[model samples]
Target: MNFIAKQMDILHHKADWFTHIVKLSPRFLLALLIIPVLGGLIAVILPAFGWAPALNQYTIGLEGFRALWQTPGLSTMMLLSVATGLVSTLLAFVMTLLILAAFFNTAWLDYIQRILSPILVIPHAAAAIAIGFIIAPSGMLSRLISPWLSGWELSPAGIFPHDPWGISIILGLTLKELPFLLLMALGILAQPEFGKKLREQHKVALNLGYYPMTAFFKVILPNLYPLLRLPILAVLAYASASVEMPLILGPNTPPTLAVAIMHWFNDVDLTLRIKASAGALLQLILTGCILVLWLAGETAIKYSFRDKLTNGKRAYNSAFWQKTTYILTILVISFILLALIGLIMWSVAGFWRFPSVIPEQFVLSHFQSASVQMVNPLFNTLTIGIISTIFSILLTLLCLESEQLNSKPISNFTSLIIYLPLLVPSIAFLFGLVWLQQLANNSSAYISVVFSHVLFVLPYVFLSLAASYRRLDRRFSHVAASLGAKPFKVFLQIKLPQLFAPILIATALGLAISFGQYLPTLLVGGGRIATITTEAVTLANGASRRTSAVYAIIQMALPLIGFILAWLLPKLFYKSAHR
Candidate 1:
């Protein structure tokens, strides 16, 4: 009897400890995310004004800004950054709305989702490299049409993939960001209550003599845009200051402001750090201006369309618009597919001259040679991705569970906090973070890199898991409680099992985000640690095409394998449970 009573007491004590940890999770997560950003910004602000103690420059001045202003091609770099960001974002937003307008509430929507879902796992760097391979002057498309169609025995001489106008950068950003915005919209539409209301509204408009597309634009879009605003803004910020994509596909003469900032930061002269910090701040300001312009454009369009929205005149010639949407969708998907094919072909090509439809021969030497060099980077990539993803999932689950225990949802302020990492330009604050890391004298590059990854990865993991976590039926929990199960046990056994699929999916997404990280890994690791993305980006810049393609393929394959496992594991678990 004494032993039984002691066991009960110990269980109760453990339960209390678990509850405390759950309650503390929210505060811990907020601090973990918010502190680094705040600290990094402070660090950058000081250095930008030329007050770096490490360099023994204690006096503050505007010398950094002055140097930044006089830098050659500064104006061109700034223009390219703004133009590429805004154009890509606008194109992606328009494409997303058109695709949603044409396919929402139809079986076609499901088909489209399945087809594009895998694209999410393709990292931005890998996608950029693939697109480069497809559209370069000597790329696959040129080879396909060379001797036969273009009547040329040589690859075409045209500006692309490194075009001075940054068109290739815009194309790469648009293609990669389109899937993200589309998926976010789809998730919102997938909500049972909201989706049903939208479908009913569309039906009501149809009965009132509205064309399907017209009805969607008039009735559905206004309601949808509010929910999509945050995501759209996030896309704008990222595209405006992106590093990896620009590094691979952007022009070198005066690369985008973000890439130029990275170059300045890495230059051999330590004085360049001050200029880089100044450039980082300017990049931040430029991104802010672009976002402001976008918002103003939104306001103007809203007023301009206010009357037309309620004019009661339906668009009658919907067939052409619908056909246009279909064709555009097909073209986008085809480009992505062809890019993948190009990567595969280059990975195995053997000394084929240009204008040839196919390589003269195929060889495995690229893969065999690259494998030896890839081992350490591959291991480091997996280590960082796995550790960071696990931490993100655990924290996300705790925060959600705490919400359940308290019977309250997170506030608007907290939502903004959750999105802070996404909304802020990475290049803006990451340098500040490196400065702080050095000041603290912490030398574990691996730990620093993993922690840095968590800041970015946590937001994505939470966004992915929160909806499913909240939508889970509460009845199961109540029944378990009535059967005398403790809260922790219920969470571990009942809730977790029910949420296995979503958790796995979120885990895969977190891994994808981690795998794609370039700036965070490079800056935080202090150039001591290399990952697949870093290796891939380095090779894509100057190495042989065949070798770059091999790394790109491997980089893409990692996340895809994670997604595949996420899909397969849930089915196997449920089947066995039934058995």
Candidate 2:
């Protein structure tokens, strides 16, 4: 009886609290929007299980499952997907460590950031295309060095670009994912006391006679791992299920599973859509399994190293290895620079053929031609990207502030939503959206495309804003309230001023994300729209390499512009404020 009375009192307290809040602020209205979000999830989940009566499938069974299981090359494709994802992730982790160890306190960091941001903003599809153009036997690399150095023609048998073993795909993804990981790690390592902590950890390991890199691996990396886990998982999800990069860089005989799913979805045979949906569900399952493997590996590494650190031993100690690592780091950075240069060369090349170190002819013609015909799509991309980024930034700031006010956990839910599109096969949710689109009969507009971009853009905005939000001083808000400012007024007056730098950064990052979207644009815009990214992907599907490179350059341009805005906005604003 006492327990029942306690529960009743708790209920009464909750009801009173809810009534108070519901009457207090208009911001509470945002909670009502979640209903549509949940409804969308339910609509997809039902059809995903073969329960859609609209498709004349009233009954549920494992037939779709059986079909997905028996798809040709399914197992090999799954393995390849997993391998590519894992290898790219592992390489990115190691590369980030190497760069940090080598350049953490050095002047090299600024130069590295300058060179990398442009490369990072280059779309995945564009990277794949650039790499494909360079590494193919008949590609530019062979044309430049092959017969002169090796005394052989650039032959068709020189299968380096889309090699059967999927190494090229892994390499392409690694190159693309590395810059992002490095950028994310920059924000993390820039936090207060991180440098002091890393330096302290280094001293301790050095006193124990461990090499600096080894010290990082043994101590600093473990601490960094948990901080980095979400971005790593997000990358793994992308490498596994990416459609564009794999399509350009993967094996021709049997493409990556993501590509295969796309083919199944687009196949003229209507029933194949069922198989595609099943494959999407399987992709989700595979993503979950790989995440488990990743976590298990993380645990194993932790346990394996915990005792070594507890004792006075360095398991990774090697001065010679450290020297070699330094050399390798230089080489990798050089190669990435080379890749960026190659992209620039291709963007400007007019009639450069293979075996020429320089373009036989250079012209401004490509850019001019691309610009003239490309204006409409470019306008669409910028408008959508800018609008969506603005919306995402506004919503993210409000949500973060709301979460802060309510003392609720914010990171996990926002991170999950942001990374969801990256990790799961895009074809799955996109396919589910087809029915929603059919119902609305209004999927092919700039509005729908921008909405899809928002889904991708929100998480990045949230992720970028999170650290600033968490580390923010709460005293300012309290003081503002004490001064008789309302919560909204306090946010505008107190929070916004302090967060201007981060807000601008997040908005620019969000714009870059929206500008780079390919599948969502394609899926939602229904070919009635043409962003540079979508146009690049489509042009690459044909035999016109020249025209494709033109689009690729345009695709790279918008993000470069966004990154410049991100980089310069704070400096300009801060200088003006100080003045």
- Tens digits of per-residue lDDT, candidate 2, 339-374, equal 656767777777765566668788777778778978
TM-score of each: 0.96, 0.87
- Runs of candidate 2 with Cα error greater than 4 angstroms are 1-50, 102-111, 153-156, 314-317, 407-419, 439-445, 577-579
Model 2 error, position 109 (Å)? 4.7
lDDT of each: 0.91, 0.73
Q: In candidate 2, which residue pairs get closer than 3 Å at backbone N, Cα or C atoms, i.e. clash?
A: 143-354, 143-355
Where does the lowest 10-residue lDDT sum fall in candidate 2?
25-34
Q: How accurate is candidate 1 locally (lDDT)?
A: 0.91
* C-alpha root-mean-square deviation, candidate 1: 3.6
